[model samples]
Target: MLKITHNTISEYLSNRTFSSIEKIQKENNNKKYLLLLSFLLLLFIVVQFLPWTQNIQAKGEIVSRFPDQGPQTVQTIIGGRIEKWYVKEGDQIKKGDTLVFLSEVKSEYFDPNLIQRTQEQLNAKDLSIGAYENKVSAIENQARALEQALIIKKNQTQNKLVQAKNKIEIENAELQNINKNNQIAQNQYQRIRSLYQKGLKTLSELQEKELKYQETLAKVSIQQNKLNNAQNEYYNLELELSAIERDYSEKIAKANSDKQSALSQSLEGRAESAKLRSSVSNYSQRQKMYYVTAPQDGYVSSLISTGIGQTLKEGEEIARIVPDKNNIVAQFKLSPQDIPLVSKEGKVRMRFDGWPSLVISGWPETSTGVFEGHVIAIDQFLTSDGYYRVLVQPNDKYKPWPIELRMGTGTQGFFLLKTVPVWYEIWRQLNGFPADYYREDSPETKKK
Candidate 1:
């Protein structure tokens, strides 16, 4: 129990009162500081709600339209050494115009019947014993080969006969004309000779007419000789072709007889050779298909420096042809960050490389010296140069298009993403950020 004085009590109460008042003042100052800090934070957050524009910048070039199949890369269908070139660079050509010719390559035709025939002969070899098996089989193969050879030769000779006859017909027409001219010259020479004798024409004139008559006669004989030669060729080919056919038939019959004998003997060798003449004929026609022709009406823009005698692989590009049609696509490159913002439906604003980049950084709506475009597509992956690819088409919505547009011209594209509050963008920039969420959501909802 401490004794209490009235004055001491009053002094102690005064001191305690002073202490309480100081503590209250300190607490109020702390509250004021906290209130000021909170107000500043609120101001920063509210500022993020202001409007801002965001866009992706990219560089690219104008390219042929995808619908036109783009610029064509003409390639060879068959692999062979180039034999001839029909079109030069910059030459306009129609569809089916031959551009390149390749050397003809030999091809073998499949024949099942010949194989069966050979097998029959080989089976027949079994009865002759082991010593003659190889010999018999070889002979059978040789006979089969010879048979095919004779058939091919007969066909070739027949073709030759037809060609020779056609030549003879042509020569006969020429010979008829030559004979008429010769008769005219002879008549003229007789008249000149009579005139010379009657003293109406000089000896020099008569001699000249005689020489003309002889020359015409010589021409007639020459024409007749050509016709006779053609006729002789036709006759010889016809005879040779007949002989080959007869020999081929006999050999085939003998081979069949031998095979019948060998079936009892029971030895065989397999020969897979041409039994179908259709395949052979088709291959012969294809041999002429070594020439590469233009797929459509186009102009030869360029060709490989490799010329005649240079071997090209199948599907190898020999030249490039630009079609007469016009369809243009602006091709451009994007960065990895810009890829997500671009969509097929999204719009693009392009400033051609030659065209000024009249692009104001923040406000694309007020863009000048730029053209409107619609996004076409985005590439599956980045290019080798670490840039992504994006295709866009000209919108031409704002005004009439510029006249200087062309393929392969460089372009700078502004890939517009979305509109968001400037305040939100600043806040996002301060931290890490997601895409503009304000524009992604509805206006009323965002406001709420």
Candidate 2:
């Protein structure tokens, strides 16, 4: 009985020792797992505090930074039929290079020598204007000659009037003298008769005095007639002077009327000539418009009118030209809610289509195959798609953009904002909050 009790006690001791060893081993294994879990928790906490760049995402396409350097559509100022093509699609051309030749489609411009014919018409009009000008000049000269002739005629008429007045005065003086002689002779004849009656004078003497008295009377009558004739001649000379003035006035009036008519004709001809000149200039310009030329250095992207005889309306688009890709930019569309987060010169990271990229939304520094750019412009108004457009250009401070990039290529852009803790970004994103507002020149940024 004592031996059986001793064996049972030995077995119990051995089992106790084995169970203690297994417990110790299990405790050691649990301690190692606990240490590993603690290390992992500390690592997670540290990562949350790491710096994260807040960014606003956007989608866009590549375009030209300058409007003039963008795509342009070729058009014609006047409608015409395509006569020939100087270039095909995708042809590189310089400014003023002809793309197509057009023929006039309108009946008014159908004549092959339209410009030359218009020019000829203009020349004829000019010649007609010159002839009118010459006629006007001749009429002016005639008016001057008529005026000078009138002055000469008036002077001659005045001189003739003065001569007539002097002749009349001389005749009046002769008549007065004859009358006086007659009176004297009459008195002598009466005295001789009285003497004869008193037998103191001879009859012959009385007869001689009577004869002399008769002669004096005859001379008086002749002188009176001469005075009347002189008066009549003076009156006729006055009438003649009046008639000359009237005749000259009529002639001058007729000349003035003719001159006015010529001047009016000249004015009309000048107006017509001016119209013709304008027509000629317009035709000449139209002739030059027959050849459609490139507005700048570009490649012909497309031809809207392909057929040789296709007719184009006025101001219709003919083809599209893609200007040389000298200054490429990414045009990004941002949400209105995020517009306030972006500003001019804001840093941006772009991933172009067909380029491999790995992006970390909160850690842009670790991103690969992404291009750097800066915000150059932002639209004040919303775009057609209800989003604001943001223009981004290559960052001069960093690497240049890829040369193989083409216009209209799709792109994904992120506008970098304030740096914050990853925990904050995660919290804000969870709460659907916007990025924090901060100026680039803020005191905090400057200090950093």
Candidate 3:
């Protein structure tokens, strides 16, 4: 039952009118403020269209400059105390050169045969074992020569005996001729004497015939004695020659027999020495297992030894060498999201962090141009920062640009992601969608 008087009505209309005016004024002010905000927003959008406004990717050098060069470590063929180092660090070496020396622990690492033979010699306690072997070999050669000489000597002795017999026969023939002449002379003398006695010839003729017969008789006797002496001398010479030759033959035979026996002894000694040497070598080799050696050439980076001369357990990493240049691998990490785009054959560009604008083409330094390379592997484990690692093998055909371009050059890098179209960027802005949406579908289609 509230009364509605004429004044109340009038005042209420006034209040309504006043309130409508305030509302109208607020709306006008708000419209102007909104227009100003729109102007500022448009100005911002226009600025992005200017050429200077764009996001660039990252760039830098590799892990370091001047990668370390080291020689491959040569290990002991059979391990033992580092008996000695033949070449110290920084020493130049040739192929097949012995860089390190290892003294045998117990005289066993020599040739097995050599060691065994040495042991045999030791057992015999004979310093002459080696000398005996040489003597035997020399004697064997001498025996062969002597045998040949003995054969020739025997032939010569037989020839001398035959010549002596021929000389005796000739002397006997000469004596027989003289006896026949003497007989003829005697007959003539006797006939002449008988004629004289019958008075058919003079006394002078008989005397001359007797004188000639006497002279012929004397000549016959002298020739007979000469023949006898020649026969005796020939026989004596033959006997003496036979005796001398027999003595020589016996001496030569004895010498050859002695030589053979000595040679046999020498051969036995050699065989025994060889056996002992082998045993010593085997023992030396068995002891070698306790020793350790470098696998490749490198700088020793770490040593896990308890002290300078402490013994290490088997399989222990007593020391480590920073591997040589060939073993250097460029390691890098990227987010898991980037892994799918990367593969074993993916191409990548690299820059060292320390040296800006310098990209190492996987090529080696010996090449004329930047090297081409391919991805070799990806680490299965992720880093603490949730990044997976990758390994790239430089091309072998070309040398790398320089050590300045290799790993540990402190180089930082970036991989260029595929770019998006200009229209896609504009469309994304119009729809208020995420920038990534443009990667899958056009902004226009996504909005639809």
Candidate 4:
């Protein structure tokens, strides 16, 4: 019985030991899975603390740095039919190089000798102006001659008046002497008659006194008549002087009127000539316009008006030219919320459409096939597509852009901003918050 009891105890112990070993093995296997899960959790927490570069992504197209350096359309200002083509698509040309020759399409400019005919008209007007000028000059000379004649005639009339006045004075003196002689003869004749009556004088003496008295009376009458004639001659000289002044005045007035009329006509002719001259200049310039020239040195990209003999209206586009291609830039549009985050001189990473690239959004150092650039400009106004525009250019401190880059090529740009921990970035994104705003000179950025 003792032996059987001991054996049973041993068997029981052995079974318990085996069961415990199995349970231990199962626990160890479960611990192995738990340890792996804990290790993965710790690794994820550490990765969340890693640095991440915050960036804004935008799609854009390559363009010229300047508007004038971009593709431009060539146009004409006058209506015409294309006569000949001096250049074709893809031809490189300099400024002022003729691209096309055109012929007049309007009737007003159809004359083959339009400029020459206009010039002839201008010349004829010039001749008319010259003739009027000469007429004005001749009229002026005539007026001056009339004035001189008036002065000379007035002087001659004045001289005649002086002579007449002198003659009147002489005649008046002779009349006074005759009157005195008559008085004396009258007195002697009376005395002779008294003597004859008293018989104290002879008949011959009385007769002689009578005859002398008569002769004195005749002399006085003749002297008075001469004085009257001299006075009449002075009056006639005054009238002739007045007539000379009146006649010359009329002549001078007529001459001055003629001069003024000629001057007016000359001025009118000059005005007409000025109009003709303007027309001639316009025609000459129009003739030059027949040859459409390049506006700048460029390659002809396309021809809008192609066929010879095709008619084009005024201000019609003729062709397109692509100017310098060296100054290429990327134009990107950003949302309104992103405008405040973008600034001039901000760093950017770009991936061209045709180039293969592997992008790690938060790890720029790990990115491949991406080019570096910087913000050169930002638009103050919203674009037509309801977004703000930003301009990015190649960063000189980075690798040069691909030479195969062409204008209008598609580009994807990443505008880099402040750096932060991956956890914070993820948290901010979860909360719909903007990236942390930091100035370029901030200590936090400098520390990075």
Candidate 5:
């Protein structure tokens, strides 16, 4: 066991066993080689200490910041060949702008598997609706009959009420006649009584007068009873009229309820039929209005399946539309290794293709016409290409990109990662290091 002090190591290197190394050094220590070697070492050390903000450069494009409902993909309504193109790509169009026309297609002439099946189904549905129409008509007729019967019953009730009034009036007249005869008999009895007392009238005559008065009184009592009976019968007739009214009302209500149920059923059938009819009508109209129109005001961003004579199947995509100006965003793609370094704090330097600009790495002062942007968000997952899609917005501190900046223009982004010793990043990249700049415990990771 031995402890090798610094002096001991130096002395060992100076020994004759290391004399071969010493000799080689002495022979090759020419002034030019020594000078060149010293200069390279100095340069490497200086570069390692220089302020190097890691800049991740990725080729990207200027993309529109379309709203949730902005961009749309137009598709063909039927299987047909393109007859003509009314507008080309990059054309600014208003809503309902004609883009391309498709040739006419019908079930009889052009019967694809899907189109033929759909047409047959529509025909079957139309036929099925006839039964519902019959049901509706039958229900309506029943309702009408009930309504007419109710009217007739009401008229009969009114007639009965009038008859009861007439009977009451006749009975009242008979009662008055009986009352007049009773008064006349009372007067005759008085006169006869006076004469008999004077012996000028016979006893039989007086008795006869008394009997006549009694008969008249009896007739009055009988007639009064008849009047009371007639009045009771009149009330009873009124009750009958009320009962008839209630009975008819219930019948009419029931009939109306049944009719409504039938009508609702009919309407349900008709609603579905209307939907199918509209679909068929739209297809027919589309045959004449063959041109596919834009759903919104926008520029024709791109055309994929649109050309004269190109066949388009039903619902096949034709082109992509970029909605109106004002919403613009820059999309920068970054490698997984650079993901940890890209966040809200990261800076973006973009050069829109049409806008002439030069990005001077690490020297922002020398950059020319470059649009400055900031990282708004970074996708949580890598795309199919193993790159993260980073959303960028124009930096408020610097000048914004021109309003004329078009979507899908070529762009070069300089995503400024954290500033570190230039040598640290160089060494990490050389060794194929993973992203480790942002820690899980940091605010950035927690926020995400």
Candidate 6:
């Protein structure tokens, strides 16, 4: 009986041990399931926070940066049919470079009468200039000749004046002789009269003495007339001298005035000549328009859009130039919300897609080096594609960029956005409004 009881107890003990092992195994399996669930929950929480944590910068709007480009170009000055083209598209040009030749045809609508009138006016100006020149020359010659004659006449008058003075001296001497003779004749007549009174002379002798005295008086009178004539002749010569001197002075003054007038006329002639020369030069340049030359050193591009022998009007477009094909930029699209951040003078930081780790900061560059630029403009109006485009400018100063940035290159780029409060997103969501709707309107509307 003791051996049987021992056997039963041993079996029961073994059973109990087996059951405990099963319970332990079940607990281990449950703990493992719980642990797996906990790990999954933790992973989900971490994944939700990954985007926020990766970029801690305040969330705002993303925008595009538009860059400055080369100067704008146009084609025609005055409307005409293109005769020839000096350069095709993609040709570089300097200032004052000729690009195209235009055939200028006389306007069919122009009035023939007006043309005739202009021609008549030009002919009249020519004739007037010639006539004025001839008149000025003739007046000048006449003045010179008159001046010489006046000088000669003045000298001759001076000599005549001297001769008249000599004649006056001679007449005065003759008058003095006549006066002496008259005085002697008067003494004789007085003595004859006294003798007649004293009966010492006869009547015939007294009469003869009186007649001699009268004759002496007549001679003295003639001498006096001669002296008066000499004086008058001298005075006339002086007057003539004075007149000639006045005339000479006047003629000389006129001659000098004519010289000045002639000089002025010559200046007018020079001005006219210059005007004609300028007109002729302009016409000649127009005629040379038939031949077009390369304005600068550059490669000729295909005339894809515009062709030669095409009629164009004023301010028309003929061709374009790709100064350096190696100069290229990436063009991308942005949302309307990005407009404000990318202003005309705002700075841009760019990085090509698929290479974010290698960021092109401060400025987007084409291969020569990192280039600096500012935002130029933005298209507020949405395009048909619902995406607004942004333009990037490569550094033009660093020409001949690497092969990757050539004109016909494919590039990808991204524009940086301005930062704002993180709560603004929640606010916009709650209000059923866009993130930038408030900014789009005035301050009063923002509050509303």
- The residue pairs found clashing in candidate 5 are none
Candidate order (TM-score): 2, 4, 6, 5, 1, 3
How high is the lDDT of residue 239 in model 5? 90
Per-residue lDDT of 1-448 in model 3, one digit per residue for the tens? 4676545556456635688767987899999999999999988777555332111122222332234443223333443444444344443333344443344444444454654565666667355676776776677666667767767766776776677677667777877887787788888888988899999878999999888888888887887787777777777766766776687667767777777777777767667666666656766565554344455454555433324333333344444345545444456676676665556754444444444354322222222323344467777788887877776555565445455454345433333233444455566658965334232455766777
lDDT of all the models against the reference? 0.75, 0.88, 0.56, 0.91, 0.78, 0.60
Model 4: worst 10 consecutive residues (lDDT sum): 1-10
**Residue-level lDDT tens digits of model 1 in 152-176:** 8888998898899899999999999
lDDT of 2 at 253: 87
Q: Give one clash count per candidate, in the order shown.
A: 13, 0, 53, 0, 0, 0
Write candidate 6's Cα lDDT for 306-346 as tens digits: 55667776666555443332334445566665454454544
Candidate 2 residue pairs that clash: none
Alpha-carbon lDDT of model 4: 0.91
Report the number of the highest-TM-score candidate: 2
Cα deviation at 173, candidate 5, in Å, is: 15
Which ranges of candidate 3 are over 4 A from the true structure? 1-120, 123-126, 130-177, 189-250, 253-257, 288-391, 394-448
TM-score of each: 0.44, 0.75, 0.35, 0.73, 0.46, 0.53
* Residue-by-residue lDDT tens digits, candidate 4, 348-427: 99999999999998999899999999999999999888999999999999999998988989999999998899999999
User: Which regions in candidate 5 have their CA more than 4 angstroms from the true location?
Assistant: 1-45, 56-74, 78-99, 102-288, 293-313, 317-337, 349-373, 382-387, 393-414, 422-448
Which scores greater on lDDT, model 2 or model 3? 2
Better of 2 and 4 by lDDT: 4
User: Which is superior by lDDT, 3 or 6?
Assistant: 6
> Which portions of model 2 show Cα errors greater than 4 Å?
1-22, 108-110, 113-123, 164-246, 270-288, 431-433, 438-448
